[model samples]
Target chain A: MAVILITGGARSGKSRRAEMRTRAFPGQPVYVATAEALDTEMEARIAKHRARRGADWIEREVPLDLVGALVATDGGGARLVDCLTLWLSNLMHATRDWEREVTELAAALPRFKSPVVLVTNEVGLGIVPDNALARLYRDAAGTMNQTIADVADEVEFVVAGLPMKLK
Target chain B: MAVILITGGARSGKSRRAEMRTRAFPGQPVYVATAEALDTEMEARIAKHRARRGADWIEREVPLDLVGALVATDGGGARLVDCLTLWLSNLMHATRDWEREVTELAAALPRFKSPVVLVTNEVGLGIVPDNALARLYRDAAGTMNQTIADVADEVEFVVAGLPMKLK
Candidate 1:
């Protein structure tokens, strides 16, 4: 019924807020995780998150091809993409065209029949990165956020584990 | 007349929002900068900000002794402390009692009769810092923000160059 975008820095309650929003919809909830357990710490973190989510959620891990997976859903229930930033990072490492991908995702969002609560991290709010790659990633993340926010029906900023609705 | 908490990451339009808020009050605006230009890059950034602020502001560079500097103000005009994180960093480096200082600052806030706009950064939203010092700094920043936000009349979170009022 709506597209909600929740963005904040790492561990800013964006995911928790997005998870809670899924309850407002009908049928089972879909949890699309963009993060890959590439490292031991990350694997542990992912497990912890999944544990918190419980068995009720239909979990799908999509490191790439996010748009395809999202669109492939039957629009049967509320879908929560645990994060777009990690997905963006995955795409970045794959040397894919991020701009085109972002454009595609934003364009495809409104077509979803059920509400899709998206979680994302805003990483560009820190000091100007010291390296070129970090700077490039920061710029891409900022643009990606703007593109998605422009289309989302509701946008929020999380601070200190609190959600502040922006739109 | 009000205490507005402006919290965001670096370069997130926080300073700009704080600057605009200063216009709503009586008398001149006071700019309390806690950042010390210890490096060439920092010096350049400080100069750029000072130029943007223009010559009208009564600029006070308070690297430490934030509460004292604040209390010493004549309670006239809008006061902006364009970041508490920097001040905290200064205290952290000095091995001072930051918790006590934070408590004192919060206690002293209500005494400022006119509007006081405070700027701060949120550094805890990312992955757990790889280093102990970074982690400590991040935790300190979060606690400090909460301490001040609890006392402030209003709090806003800025993301993607926009502000969302939280209180």
Candidate 2:
């Protein structure tokens, strides 16, 4: 069993890189997408991403409650959590239960049986945003990354379509 | 002489990490800031950042012409280019020959006598932006980072307040 955490800056090809690493595991793949189409633009983006996947893979559109989504996956199945940052953003905008949700999300990663690769956006290197909400999201994402990276069996930082192992 | 490129997601402590790495060099330091305070919020941010630095640094507030800014530094001065993304953004908004400017900027690195640390934000790891300008900026930043990282003697990716050497 492997819990691989993949992180990188926006559009650094993190999702493609994360998916590539999951190929070593022998099972029907599960793509656990954490994005919701709140707007037409986002819906189009989601549709574009979804169209690129292989036909046989199972898809789970999980906006939040990642713990519950993970519980339903097969232990031997290769599960790809397309991203965690968006889910964090979703929670940040919704009810103020993000801390509890993040803790539960971290605790649930260990329950997977085979290989599970997680994709998380690295958004902390730019100027600190002027708004309080953006800062809160940044802090929350950083904390979640550290927590997941700690428990991950492998960690990689993707840049310019390449993967640099961090742990 | 050493050309070091430092990159990370926004607010990932890339700037501070870059300045810290330059401490080993024995020379007067240069902090070449590429940001322009076009608005009140930005002006406040710039003032706050400037307040954090010690008085000894040779501060060069160069907004667009990075190559010219570097050319003015002392040969042995420890140059810390606080950022490249804002410079790129500024160029995008301005009517100027950016390609030529970038070429010159890359060519100026070898002329430095001591360590020169360049900090850049990785903005390509998130969803593809819905707007054209954002997409253009993202692509431009990625290209610029790759361009610098190629010529730099060393490159590092910072995350969650930690530095991980990439090359």
User: Highest lDDT: which candidate?
Assistant: 1
Lowest summed-lDDT stretch of 10 residues in model 2 chain A? A123-132
- State in Å the error of residue A66, model 2: 1.1
lDDT of 1 by residue, A1-167 (tens): 69999998665566767888886789899999999899886797799888888899888899988888888775688999978988888999999998999999999999888789999877765566667787888788889999999999999887855777789
Task: Give me the displacement of residue A39 in model 1, in angstroms.
Answer: 1.2
Report the alpha-carbon TM-score of model 1 versus the true structure: 0.61
Model 1 misplacement above 4 A = B1-120, B124-164
Model 1 DockQ (Cα-based): 0.19
Docking level for model 1: incorrect
Cα lDDT of model 1 by residue, B17-112, tens digit: 898888678898899899988999999989998888889999889998887777777577888998898999999999999999999989988877
Each candidate's DockQ? 0.19, 0.19
Candidate 1: the clashing residue pairs are A1-A115, A10-B125, A125-B10, B1-B114, B1-B115
What ranges in model 2 sit over 4 Å off? B1-121, B124-132, B143-167
The alpha-carbon root-mean-square deviation between model 1 and the true structure, to one decimal in Å, is 6.3
lDDT of 2 at B45: 76
lDDT of 2 at B111: 73
